[model samples]
Target: MTNVQGMIETCVQCGECVEVCPFYKATGNPSYGAMAKVGAARSLFAGEGLTEEGLKTLWLCTRCDRCVSTCPVGISVPDIVQSARAELRRRGQWPQKCSNIANAIIEHGSPMAAPPQDRITYLGKDHNVREKAEYLYVPGCWASVRLPEVARASFQLLTKAGLDITTLGEKERCCGLFLIDNGLMDEARELAEKNTLLLESTSAKTVITECPGCYDVYKRVYPALFREPNYEVIYIADILKDIVEHGNIEVKHSGRKVIYKDPCPLARRYDMTKAAREVLGHVAEVVEFEEHGAEAVCCGAPAGVKPLYPEVANELAGKLLKEASSKGVDQVGVGCPFCMHHMSGVQNGTEGPLRIRTPSQLMLESLASER
Candidate 1:
């Protein structure tokens, strides 16, 4: 159990959290505010526990952590809410959507529910994945099953750059960020341990992922849950950026004006805005959305919100897309496959007002042009 007393003391209630929280900003509900969430959890901790209504309210958070950045005292309201969710799950009061995800992962090894044997099919065709290589690429569940293009492009770029990389294929499992967000820490820990062991089994010194959620788990959560990872975990954006800047790979300039939507975890959590933009500059004219970097809005995918409250998720994604539409860019480039999936779903058509593309996809376009 996290120390609610310390979290409660950290909030100054200055309305800074409310200002940036997706639920509060979209619905204008003070009860959905981040500070209010902390207060609610504090009350529950002091008393018996939260009611069903209180549990739902706690799950409303997108877990963007914007409030943590804005709080005068640096209170992590999302973490508090996550802790409350754990308590709710223990009492069987958690959301069914999140519970389903946890169950799916535990039962099926991946949240997408595909058989483990089919995992290698996500690679499209089996390329020679060396067992002992410098890079071990783990395409999180979303990219592996839902959006394989991003994974394929990332793999192609890595291969083209002449770096020796290996993949676990079906051996890879969920990084368990979904479980962690829903307060299923034990389940998350189990997955994390499995992933750590799998990565350690390889001679690769670095682990790469296209999913921001998986990267966050490997970079932040796993270290705390287990021992510090002996291997380095990297976002594909940073990997591609280095490949471009160091002259290992060259891409013909597309000259297309594109707005980049910074995935909340990548932009705010990992401080990866610069690397993403630096890579974008190599292929396209990088245009800024109305909100970029730490101030950027959520696309409605974080903290299991996309599956739990899709209406709310789509509403938030619509707002993000609207900002990009207003800019009149040719395409919207995103680093996170989760963000790209939601954004693509919200777009009007295959060739809508703006195309939603992975950063690696955009780079591949230019790289292909050069070829």
Candidate 2:
């Protein structure tokens, strides 16, 4: 059990967290507030248990850690909520959506519950997949299943730059971020060990991923759960930034103006807020959100919130789109595939007023224009 008593004892209940919590701001539910979540976590920690409502409150959190930044005492509400969720899992009281996704990842190696064979279909028959390489590109479940275009663009950009990159293809499994988010530590650890072994077998010294969730797990969570990875884990944005800056490939400037939406994991967790901007700046005129970088607002699709609370997720994503529209940009360029998926879903269509695209896709557009 993760002890959060120290965190709970430090809270002064100043309510700073409520002002920044997207869940609380969107739903206006006091129970969904960060302070109330700490209280629920306390109850669960003390073995008093939580009501169904309290459990729902815990799950409502996206773990964006905005509350942590606001708390004067530096109380991490996300950590407390994660601990509370572990208690719920122990009692078999976790929500059905969590259970379904967990089972899909464990049984089928993806949250989509699709067969492993479905993972490689997007690569096309003529795709070249090396058996061993120096860099392994992991598109993650979202890129592999939900948004293949992101994967295609990223892979194409890397190859165009003449880097030695290969993918796991059908042998890849979920990075187990959902398990960690939902407090299924044991299952998450199993996945960490499996993925680490598979990655080591490829003799790849670096693992490059297009998904922020995958990068977070491979770079941060996996090491903490077990040992540090032998290979370095990097985000595709960093690679794209290098490729654009070095002039390895000619890219014409795009006339489109874009607002960059920073993914929480890359911005707040990893302190990586510049790479995507540098890449996007080369191809398009990049704009900023009112709150960006470490303080950027979340897209509200992470963890199990989108699957469990669709309305709240939509409400949160809508906030970003409305803000982008006010900025009068041509589109929103996101560094994370999950953000692209959620924001694009809420935007409704590719030809919609507010467009959502990855940095790689935008760069690909620039490359095509030069041709």
- Clashing residue pairs in candidate 2 are none
Q: How displaced is residue 152 in candidate 1, in Å? A: 0.3
Winning model by lDDT: 2
Q: How does model 1 score by TM-score?
A: 0.94
Clashes of 2: 0
Encode model 2's per-residue lDDT on 14-120: one tens digit a residue. Answer: 88888688887778887788888988888887889588777778988888877787888888898888888887888888788889999999999999897777777
Per-prediction CA RMSD (Å): 2.0, 1.6
lDDT of 2 at 47: 81
lDDT of 1 by residue, 1-371 (tens): 54656977666777877767888766777777777788778777776656655655687887887778888776788788888878777777766777788888888877777776665665666475567788898888888888878888888889899988889887778888878887788887877788888888897799988888888889899988877887999999999989998999888889888898888887787677888788888888999977789888888677777887777778788887777878878789887888888888978543467888888899999977886
Model 2, residue 237: displacement in angstroms?
Answer: 0.5
TM-score of each: 0.94, 0.96
Candidate 1 lDDT score relative to the true structure: 0.81
